[model samples]
Target chain A: MIRFDKISWSAGSFALEEVSFAVPAGSYAVLMGRSGSGKTSLLEILCGLRTPSSGSLWIGDNEITSLSPGERGIGYVPQDGALFPTMTVRENIGFAQRIRGEPAAATKATVGSLAERLGIGAVLDRRPQNLSGGERQRVALGRALASRPQVLVLDEPLSALDEELREGLARLLKDIQRDLKLTTLHVTHHRQEAAQLADHVLRLENGAVVRESGPPQNG
Target chain B: MTLRGSRWFWGLLAGITGAYLAFILAMLAATAVYSAPSDLWKALQSREIQHSIWLSLCTCTVTALLSLFIAIPSGYVLSRATFPGKSWVQAALDIPIVLPPMVMGLALLILFQTWFGRLLEKAVALTYTVNGVVLAQLVIGAAFAIRTMHGTFDHLSARPEEVAMTLGCSRARAAWLVTLPAARRGIFAAGTVAWARSMGEFGPILVFAGATRMKTEVLPTTVWLELSVGNLEAAVAVSLLMVVFAMIILVAVRRVGERV
Candidate 1:
């Protein structure tokens, strides 16, 4: 489980006050908020991209507040995918493994299997610039999973996709989550996406969680 | 003729200007090439000339590498972090670029003649040595590298490095593996420019290292020495060599820039 307690942070004119939440293991939680509602900030803090002014974060049995981002074992996928343009898709997927000092042969096999499962095997040689929005998102998802993270945090992963692509990608994401059985925190303002993908929903307004909805199936 | 004729005339005029500029550049290239071969042979055979060229290349390469090593972290910090006096730090990094080279050399000389130089000299002599030439080049070359790299890092989104960090790479490792690869072309271009800047450095070497022939004498200093002794051919030879190296660097930078 991933938990944030009494998190407070101020960035310029924006402030997040007393934000608290927990995402249970093997559950998909969606953070729903309008633009400028501090969703991105919350996501950043959770992923260790930014620190809370005051708060405690816990992942599993570990208090992650004192740990660096690298030590937190959280997988983050930014809104734009943020794929390294210089690296081929295969290399991009295997990046985290390389960082963790995984054997090159093992990394290659792992990336190949992931890419095949993600349906990006054909474009493994291409760079991010050549990949479509849907394809790039898949590669990003594959990269995050390659690390076998404790909690996967995705920031607006579908915002850049077209209507035709978003629905299919959402389903793909659900299937992947189920297959990996990984706890996931997905941030998006889209109500449809939140309703479709999340097991539970936390609605943010001006940086505070105003409403916490029960599991989507219960609703 | 209609309005279209006037537009065509403007286009023709622009083309003519471009042609003229190209012609002038070609002429300069021709002059350098014409003087290079014969003079270069004589200079190359001379032990003094060989030593100066070797020293210049070695010092500049070391300076470029050191400058890049330091500049990468500094540039990333300036680009990605928000700290007190960040703007002031940026301004300080850029100060050397706009300052006249002679002024930079003078400042170095002053610092060397004072407590800092004595401290370094106590461990290893800095002034009037090969090391001094390398140090002088690094000071200026690193400024150039940082200025170029700062923009490169700034233009890139920090999301990739953040992703890397979250995946268990430390800040330094994330930068080296993720951020550095993303900005590889920019860093390469910056290194090229820094190497060229170090190679052509005259003012700093002249003041700090005192232009000792075959010892601290870099290519530019050798050129100056040749010119002072009425050896125009030898002077032009060294200048032409510098120009060739500069051209190679420029082409390489252009190619890398295009790729990025």
Candidate 2:
């Protein structure tokens, strides 16, 4: 489970105040909000990219508010993948394992398997600059899953793609989530995307949270 | 006979560029022609000239490296963080670059005469020594280096390093493994700027380090010493030598771009 308790944060003139919500384990929660509606700020709080002024973040029963970003056990895929340009896709996928001092052979095996699963096996030796948009997103997903994180937070992961590619990758995401039983919070403003993915929905408007069990009704 | 808008634009641009190049070549030609070939050879072979060449190379190289020591962290913080008085701190870095080099040299001379400076001097003399040569060069060199590094860091996005942190790498580790490698070209450019600036530095060294024979004499001071004694040939020859060094460094920086 992933939860934000009474999260209050203000930056410059924008603020999200005392926002509270939860996404159950092994389920997908779509956070829907329009532009300038604090969705990215809320996502940043969940991913440890920003700290809420008066709230605690919980991931699978652990209070992670005091943890540094690296220790928070959240795997985040930012809007454009943000892959390390210095490393090949293989290295990018295996970064978590290598960082934790996993044996080289095991990291290599994990990278190989994950690349195959993500359908990026052929491009494992290439850098992100050479990747197509879909391929880059897949490599980013592989990188996120390598650490076996407690919660997955994706910020507009499919927003960059064309219509066909977005639909295809949306299916891939659903399948992977179901296969791994990973709890997730995917942020997007698109109503159809929320309808396609959310087992639960949280809507943000003027910095408040409103929860619904399924796709939102027309505004 | 006729030119369109694009043609006229290109022709004017080329004309201006050619005029500038011609002026520079004329300056070099004048220096090259001022002295006989034998006198130039003798200047190269002279013990004082050779010593100044070695001293200039060693001091400038040392000054460039030390500037990086000051520049990298200062640039990184200045680029990345926002704090109280941040703008003031950034403006302070430009002080050395904006001030006359002779003023900076005078400041150093005045500084060493103070209590804290005297206490520092007890450890390593910097008033009129080879160490002073590096110190004088460093004040100007580091300012340029810091600005270069600041621009470099500013252009690079912080998103990749943040992603590394999410992947179980600590902030410091992320910087080391991700940000630094991406900034390699910038670091090289910063070092090149510092070295080139230090190579041409004269006013600071002449004011602070003093032009003692075979002691603190660098290429610039060699020029000054030659001119003061009315040895115009030796002065012009040393000027030519400095130009040759600049060309070599230019080629070297370009090679770094291609290879590294």
For each candidate in the order shown, give its overall lDDT on alpha carbons. Answer: 0.86, 0.89
Q: Give lDDT for model 1.
A: 0.86
Clash totals for all models, in order? Answer: 0, 0
lDDT of candidate 2 over B3-86, digit per residue (tens): 588899999999999999999999899888988999988878889999999999999999999999999888999998879999
Q: Write out the backbone clash pairs for model 1.
A: none
Assess the local accuracy of residue B41 in candidate 1 as a C-alpha lDDT between 0 and 100: 78
Worst 10 residues of 2 chain B by lDDT: B1-10
Most accurate candidate by lDDT: 2
lDDT of 1 at B206: 92
lDDT of 1 by residue, B223-250 (tens): 9999899887787777777877888888
User: What are the DockQ scores of the candidates, in order?
Assistant: 0.71, 0.77
User: Interface-residue RMSD per candidate?
Assistant: 1.2, 1.0
lDDT of 1 at A75: 80
